[model samples]
Target: MKTATGCTVISNGTAVIGTGAAPIKDATIVIRDGKIAYAGPVAQAPEVEPDATVIDARGGTILPGLIEAHFHPTYFNVEALEDLDIKYPVEYVTLLAASNAKLALECGYTSARSGGSLFNIDVWLKKALECDLVPGPRLAASGREICGVGGLMDWNPDYRKIGMDGLVLLVNGPDEARAAVRKLVKDGVEWVKTYPTGDAASPDVNDHHTLCMTFEEMHAVVATAHNHGLKVTGHCRATEGIKNALRAGYDTLEHGTFVDDEALEMILERNTPVVPALYFELASIERGPEFGLSQRVIDGHQETLEGGAESARRILRAGGRLGMGGDYGFGWNPHGQYARELSFFVNYVGLTPLEVLTCATKTGAEILGREHELGTLEAGKLADVLIVDGDVIGNISLLEDRKRFIAVMQGGIIKAGELFRSQA
Candidate 1:
């Protein structure tokens, strides 16, 4: 794949299926012009480009590159949200975001959807990755999240003259919400992320259960973004927030920890995808001390964790799509450990290993609206592939190591690992 030519082929592997009907044994995948030409048994392999580069998986598992449905590339390696909002300079955060992107790619994630970012960093980074100016995943960029004043993202001290300007778009009403979303579209965002509720980490009246936006403001955001050809997702953990987002035509939900019967019904009826982001809550409880969180805050996180798990199960049982990813760049959950979400699904959410893989790949792509080109290994799909050296089905934890990958290829280009020889 380093030969400058985009033609490549990968052979001699067992393909783990992702929305491709079923798995294949002794498979051969061919990539021509950065797109899949064949993906099936080696016996029926087709001819490839005369000088095409070929990679031997050595009887490994060939799977679709994992997708991160909610990623914060601009947060960097911050110890807390305050670091991201106050201490870290915009220039440093932007540079650190580039490193995180490369790290995520090295971890075998070929695609990422930006949940939100500081200013328009995600916008510029997405363009850079697309144009080959940087090495990263195919990013669906969402710029600074729109939040109501004093909401979850409005973390600045009101009495202080200085404010956290780079982190959020502080909108006060319906008109401001509409303008915020329109400005995001104009700034080159593909998705609009909003704060429809507060955080459980907060202790005041603005707790996780507090509604951040009125119905009118939420409705205006959805309408404006949809009109400008963008999908709207929200940070909605409150039950009322979920209901409000649903009624306002929000396309997706993030961290739906407090969803109830009605919200579950609404989600299924609309077929809205949700990335439960279960790990962050657990991380807070387990590693909260290291981050200076109080005992009360840690206790609150335990409740949030239980509620998120139950909500996730209910959504899955109802046959609603559930994608993986959440707050991975924070101090507790660093980058390159994205595969942990898969384990959380199996051990906590009660999903099987196969089910977790399918959700992370196929359903994640569906959430990002790239179901055709990504999420599966088949003819005509982009060559976004991960060659794993171990039996992924038996021990999903092996994915936590970047070295476990024999090669990570996206669009016929090798991003990590090495594939030296081929027989085509």
Candidate 2:
């Protein structure tokens, strides 16, 4: 239900404002015209009109809606990589993408940025969400990823005559790189995804340490993306690849696993956001055998798990931005289990719950360039709020329980949660 123009108040909650501020006890949130008119202690809450719709939070935790910094809407039940592009036709994949978007919103994510998608599905998905044809998160869409021939994403054999074109645009040189960025711009993408390094999943040919795209190609991609008013992020893991991306003025790094001191210095200097995406490694290590992955692949995932966690810790200690989101939509780590990434960071990565929450909310928004309006529960910001039935600060895993989500408000409307049915 749309919030009335007069007011809608959320009362009797403990506010865990996403600005890293301490939780405010007995907090109240006032919504007016789809914006936060006030959010503070209940005693200080402004007077509301008599007809205002007041939803009682019942002493729950109220925080900003979570943001998924690296989302892949087209990757569902992906046991093998071919499931990403080849197994399902584009028509079925589009429907799957729409389902994943709604799943993300129901899981408490109100905003997301596409890490990559098949057939530029996320571009049209964003429009569908805007028109309310779909119930989903606000999205910053990146079409197909840009990959060098024989890179991590280029798994299909050329002789098969079935290319990787559905998921990635394979480019050979700097000119092709620029042309690929132009294609993404024409497709109406807000961000450009690139593969600068290979993955541990492809250990034999292009392992984690190998660079996929040349420095010149990387630079051309960044330059062209920036020129066309789009930001570029890369699946960077190797030290050299990370350095190349940073030197090329890339906007963000995904799975920045092997950051040496030199790369750390560069990252801190540039103030770039690094999404460790460590949860995917953990899932791979634990469940690879079930999916017919070889022992070598499992070992590679174990190594990546350790290295990515350590890099994330170092980045956090050095005051760098460490956002949260991982490669979900696989068989083990499915789309609705998005909050597991936050739990993994707190339990395994040695970060406090509050720290992980900040990464998922505040830093995640900063990475999307929407921090000013959507990251925090402050006055004058968009009324994107999540009211949990428990103290999420004390038990961060409470966010994983959708039943505990009393209300999930996006733009002051009750989009999902236990209270949504009554409100609608």
Candidate 3:
């Protein structure tokens, strides 16, 4: 055998049917220098080098590592709102992010895109992982969300006194929006998030189609971000807001609840992917009362739950690109339960098991503009993979438990492992 350093092989596994259209049974995945070198049936796999290490998969099912396209690390504590005051504290928030990161990794999410966060903590967490100071998924973060004055959440005036300027940008007009985008880029933001439409609790004072930002203002944010080599994502729930965001060149639309037929057509025409964070709606309905939410909030959530599913169905029927993302950190939604999003996608959004898996893996990497580096199990791609104890395709819900995973590896390093049995 040829000699090589830094090599490992996962043998005798059932490779989960991938985007390539077929499953490779009795498979072996060879890794070299943190990249996949070969992935196929063991009988077809080329001979490995003499010094390579081998991991026996014990007939487990292997698949490309999962990716969560929209998550919030800092606000993860919203899962248990009885502890609200303490959950938002900076120290507590940091610990919560750390805990969520570890949970996500262990749960087979090798990479994630943090949609929005407070205090720009996602940036710090990303840096920490890169430096090996912490263990977590590979992260792409929007430092903080930029919203219109009194847009989504009210900003506290005390933020100025505490020097927490990087938390959120509350801009009022076109000029302010441009400046805010510039400031976020200067602060090392990977992407810029904007709240284009108001929520149920805070509807836009203008027409539903007319959002907080004028067309010019929205254009400025998108232009500034694109000029700086960054992408822009918008929170849009209304049909009017969805069209405006598409016209403004936003990369992705989040939580599109009231999307009409025409807007769904536009999304298909434009080829912009929509992240239907249905888990947020489901969790809100099931867990809102525990958090002391008023009846009105609970009722409003029910309406959204019903409406969002219909919109998702329409989007899928129209052949629009759809991705899976759990809006974790609100109501009972928590990090590391990403697979549940797939179940909702399959049952509620009408996606097949293969399609849902692609949304979480291949489509997710494409949304982040990292398809070549992540997404599929291919030669030269990062070695992010998961091996489950049973055939996950038949029952996707089995993925909800980390214990079902026989091995979790990221960058060719095994993060978790099951104890070995003697070869008697």
Q: Whole-model Cα lDDT per candidate? A: 0.85, 0.91, 0.76
List, in order, the clash count of every candidate structure.
0, 0, 0
RMSD for each model, in Å, please?
2.7, 1.3, 3.9
Ranking by lDDT: 2, 1, 3
Residue 263, candidate 2: Cα error in Å is: 0.7
Residue-wise C-alpha lDDT for candidate 1, range 1-424, written one tens digit per residue: 1213456778888887687356688988888777888888889998776887777888778999999999999987577676777776788888988999998898889999999998689999998898888888889999888889888777778664334357688888999999888888789899999989987788675677888888899999999998999999999889999999999998899988898999999999999998988888888888889988888778778888899999998898889988989788878878877888888788877887788888889988998899999999878888899999877877788778777789888887777865422211
132-224, model 3: which lDDT tens digit per residue?
678778889898787777555333444444223435677778898899889888778788888887655333352223365566778889999
Where model 3 places Cα greater than 4 Å from the true spot, the runs are 1-5, 79-89, 155-166, 200-210, 417-424
Residue 360 C-alpha lDDT in model 1: 88
Q: Write the per-residue lDDT of candidate 2 for residues 260-373, one digit (tens) a residue.
A: 999999999999999998999998888888888889988988888999999999999999999999899889778898899998998999999888989999999999999888
**Worst ten in a row by lDDT for model 2:** 1-10
Better of 1 and 2 by TM-score: 2
For candidate 2, the per-residue lDDT at 37 reads 94
Instruction: Give the CA lDDT, 0 to 100, for residue 19 in model 1.
Output: 77
